[model samples]
Target: MTASVLSRAGADLSTARESLARAAQRVEDLLGALPVPGLRSLEQRDRAAAAHNEVRAHRVDFMATHATEVYDELTGGRTRDLRLDELVEAAAGAFPGLVPTAGQLAVERSRAQADKEGREIDQGIFLRGVLRCDLAGPHLLTAMLRPTTRALLLLPDFQRTGLIEMEAVRLERRDGVARLTMCRQDCLNAEDERQVDDMETAVDLALLDPAVRVGLIRGGEMTHPRYQGRRVFSAGINLKKLSAGEIPLVGFLLRRELGYLHKIRRGLCPREPEQWHAPYLDKPWVGAIDTFAIGGGTQLALLFDHVIAASDAYFSLPAAREGIIPGVANLRFTRIAGARLSRQVILQGRRILATDPEAHLLVDEVVEPAAMDDAVERALTRLDGAAVVANRRMVNFAEESLADFRAYVGEFTVQQALRIYGEDVIDKVDRFSGRSE
Candidate 1:
């Protein structure tokens, strides 16, 4: 009886493998026929998008239904200690045209042109499919938390001096606090690839430091004529760079969420999967909002344990007008502000002022501009006294677990990609008049 059952199970495994192989072949054929070369014309783009969507639908369905089976096959039945990039490479080889290899994606990012839009869209769709696979989604997300190559190289210097200054960000560890200041003065402290890379490296420095008990993020003084010498929390995505096709979806959108912001919220994951459930190496983060937090800036405030804002400050997520999904705001805003208000804030581009009663949802303390420094110090002291790591871990476990984040990213990956390349977004970017908001 045991031999008969084993034989049946073996047959089923063989059948599933064969089905996957055939599906992969079908995807290869479809992609080969619909070669996404430049897509110069509207008609060409539309047709290519439709073809990509079909491929995406098929891939999503297969992964959703056979996530474990697919993962098992990719890893050769070894689930433990799997690296994310390795798994991605394996998938790219096994399922040609479904996903780009890491090297290919890197090359595309380096090019950063309108001509590469189709390939970028395909990469996003492929990531969405990967994120759907429960076995792989969380792994990929966790892998992003590891320090970047730049960060790793600078670690020794940071350890020696407790300060590292990059072009767009500066980090200093002092009195048990790792202070990260955004330094894109000319752009009103807006985020771009340079800023994001520097910011992530700074965050990595803070997390890796044993003496650091808390992390703080605040914008540096701006050089824009109107806001010259004054701090502006952040102007959000650098519209100029984004409109110029300098912002690749994977490098900026995906990396910002999966990398620094996530590191700030959940801390660093253990190298071993067995230890993931254990408490992460985390510290409470504080956001010091000076003038305003707009779009991606507002999204950043949501991840902090404590947010301190100047009485005259305000926050807004104008992603609706920008024609792209605000990074993870949809998943997070509703929880803080109720569904209705969150809708107003996100969908209607409503701005919440620091002095308003409703601002309490996003800001923990509102202080006069002159008193901001004192307020931040007091908040840090309070956080230091409390069991910050324990409390944060408990709160996150209840509010946004790894599984919850994984699912949200899985869906977000595809939606944001489509929005980024949509006609409406292109039109909006063309009409942008150099306004920070």
Candidate 2:
């Protein structure tokens, strides 16, 4: 990672510079008008610009410094005469990834490639020397297939983001066991649209990896704005970068490899024998979902069996909040909380207070912020042997008795979500965006 080579990669970035700027400007505008009583007068625009530029600056530094190391790995040769243009044509389709074939592949002899070779190749192609760190392995190996640490994780920060700071995942060692902690900032914690996606992808990949055991998540409130100044916009969420980086791949890998979801039997509804008992009667796992467990965050939490929650963790069926409801989340919530709690969860915009006794019904333990981490540790500590498993099975079988309580009469409601993103939503966006109609 030297200064000369990073300069070349930095050159490939002229195209994305402007996009980075607009995204930052829009964020500053929205933060200015937030409903917070004392925040109104704060000039966050400058800070936003600085943060945005910091990421961009890091990109320039990486390009000038790390480019040679990047190129050498991409276009290694017996002759140390490989030029940037030669490397581009040699590894065109896979300039930033790995070799199509395995070790010690031949390099394309020669070609005078164009300056902007981006359109000449597909985005998914591998570069000759990019290293993908193998987390599951005992020994560390770096090659052309993928990147390790900063190269893969911090590349975007170097490219689109303008700053770099410590982003070490907190690992606490207790009784020889290591637990990972995820922290949350009081305000929305995204720099640009690109990093938002990158961080999410990195977290998703890191957590689901079998190498990780218990994941401690504290805050996860990610929001994006379209514009600012006089008008405001909340175009919901932007799943582009996040999705592109393979967020869903984590879930797919979990189910395919782990058989993580254990299906539960629906008990008989006393009167309607064929009808399943309680709403969560026939789900794969048991867990509590609360406090804005909408979007990908909520979806991932459901993948776990025992969910610890805060009363304020408001869970919402955001499908309607968008434009559709595949009834996917319902497939689980209906059974666990039974029909009654499930109905209230979706049909009514309700916040299942974690402090409330009702939260304990869904989760194993419900405690205040200070005690939540302790409760999770206790749950894990006692899980060392077979007794916990035996008790879990016993409790699950007993849960079958609650199937009769799943019934309730009501239609699904979309008013709150609608209000959040309705004409008012568009108006706030357009007004701030200076695109008001």
Candidate 3:
């Protein structure tokens, strides 16, 4: 039923695969052993077929087992109960505060969507044309059953990196107006700063890129409605299965300029934010599709100018309890939520005013979950296609005025590394150089 069970059974194919691989190597070995040209005859055809079937067995085992694993793993092990009915109910449910930002929920929805696509493809009868191999019609049929499988095979390594690289952001220009379209829904919404940064980078791509005019974001019930609203523009951060490194990576990449990174590993900030040279900030119509904008997620949503949310969006900041303060979006939250709500947010480190009208200001509009795309399109209608290019001069000046980023980070890194080392760096170097310990 699960890939785990199949994998064990598939172990037979592993041995068969290895044997076939060795069989190729042993053609010479057999020549050496027999002291003759080799065995000949009609058995050669059966032999080749056996080898091909061995390869096929391995391939089938690998494809089926791996695909099932992908589903289970990406589904957070909930694939056991993953049914179409549950997916639809969850998508339509009024959920807010369960996740911090729409980005996280967006990922969940994407998975659900993929699952639906797979089921539909499975049920369809005429999808055989696109199949690559008919030897195992089931494999071909399953490929049809899961259209996203092709996409998965194309970018087979995405499972490791936890990133979804979009070839193009959907944009529609109709009647001299521009609107964004939705891509496939599966997502990895990470609350980590680095993942937050990746999402931010994507936002700039979606909203500001001349190549993309609009993007439809999907979200989860867990996000703050304020941030979740941004799912209208793009996928928000999803915290599901995100590691600690990923959490800060999301925020750091989004907020900090990568130019600020230290040449040496700096211990000062949690991580370095990636710098993007491409111009996107000047665009006034940058939009967000956020889910679970808690802590870092909320920070990411604030980075965008436009946000569309479901009725169930939620918001909060919990970095205070972690003994480190959030430097990224708390500055903006403090201004918008005021001193009191901000205090409760950081100090209490829990959901406070997620459903309140006060949080509504963080987003431009609120709508039923189904109407999220409509809301985003409606907002895009008011834009004049103006972008802020003049600010580049000011940005250049600002960069020039700032302290040398490398040195600034290097100094802190040296101090902290030396501090943590106590006497280790010098001692190690000196010892390496044959000096006293």
Candidate 4:
């Protein structure tokens, strides 16, 4: 009932879902086609309405039966808890467009907590509320059921990659603090798929290693002439790849969602039973920003638990100027800087200086360039302790529900995927726009 059988069952479930959707669409079309009241003879209008109602009833019946069948098949009729693989598959069948999101496993646990506190609401009504609250439907459903699904594998050992050796990312640990620096300075640390992969691996290594209690992310020396001899955070996505037509926009978006953004949202750690209640990493993440944190750099800053930025640092998301969407920022920044500020930065390419109040809100502290090391030390001092993880967990619970974050990521991924395939929107910036020989 596992391998091949599970695959076959999944296929059947997809087909059943497609059929149900088509049936539902037909019902909608029939209702839409019905003549307005008084526009047609009463008998004619009533007949059309009757047909619409009949099809709607049939679609509802089919959905109920099909959902049950798929669920039972995935569960092997045992009615017991299913593993993560089974749970994801079952979710796919139950909900169309199911995709992974941030704080994914904590969804059910949050609901349970609310219930215990006498704040629980009806599931259907709660889902409707989430939709009305402007969260993505798939995200809400995934969050609602993610805790029920447990992954079979836990923490895996890390193997250093050749790419890391190439100096794209430098991962090192001193005392209890692990530093994962982006060392690709040629393009101001702009990331292509390869660079992103290296950084992702470095992040996972830093977060998963039990000996390390605090993780620090920063940049290496810049080799670009304009920014030469300076330490810069990042310049966002690699335009060289886009100009050369090497990387597809959809693939780049997926890499960002799964490899980078999701990892930042949900830290890489061995899955433990308590993870549903606190899906973040077991340690705090501190980002050290120097020079500029542009585009993706700014997005990364938003994901970090704490940020230590140099006084000279600035952040910007020029996605709109480049005719591309800053997928994650557009969703996450709203919580950090309200609707108006988020709109200004993402839509209008507004640069946020570290001294600005809006920027200070995101950054934990700002220091002179020479004081960055001391600033990192101060940030870590606050985070490093036996109860650090537990303290952070409490803070997370009080701030916002993981469900909200997961819902936003769901919407971000869908929009990004669509924009990637629409027009030549992604590669709008030409490679030859300005380059030094």
Model 1 has a clash total of: 0
Q: Write the per-residue lDDT of candidate 4 for residues 1-437, one digit (tens) a residue.
A: 78998788678767766765565456446644655332556686667557544644544344344444444544554344443233444544555322222233233223321111111111112222222233233333333232211111112322222112435777777677778788887678887777765765666666666677888889988878888888999888776565444443323544465444555555543347765765556467899999999888998998778898999999999877766677567767887788999888888889999999888767889999999998888888888886867776676556546566556544554345344333344235452333212
TM-score of each: 0.85, 0.35, 0.37, 0.63
lDDT by residue (13-113, candidate 1, tens digit) is 55654665566566546555653445445766576567656766665665565565556667665444343445656767765555666766765555424
Better of 2 and 3 by lDDT: 3
Give lDDT: candidate 2, residue 65.
40
Q: In angstroms, how far off is 85's CA in candidate 1?
A: 6.7
Model 1 gets an lDDT of: 0.78
Candidate 1 lDDT score at position 31: 51
Clashes of each: 0, 51, 68, 1
Evaluate model 2: give its TM-score. Answer: 0.35
State the C-alpha lDDT per candidate: 0.78, 0.33, 0.36, 0.60
Q: Write the per-residue lDDT of candidate 2 for residues 1-437, one digit (tens) a residue.
A: 58776675566543333443454345435544443321323465355435534543443343344344444444452123322223334543433221111111121102111111111111111111111211211010111112223334653543343222334223333342224332222122212233333333333322223232333333332332421111111112332222221211112211111111112222111123442423221212223332344533443444444666654554444443333232234555666667887666666645455565666544566555455556666655544344543454456567433222111100111122123223333344334334433
- TM-score-wise, the better of 1 and 4 is 1
List the lowest-lDDT window of 10 residues for candidate 3.
Answer: 259-268
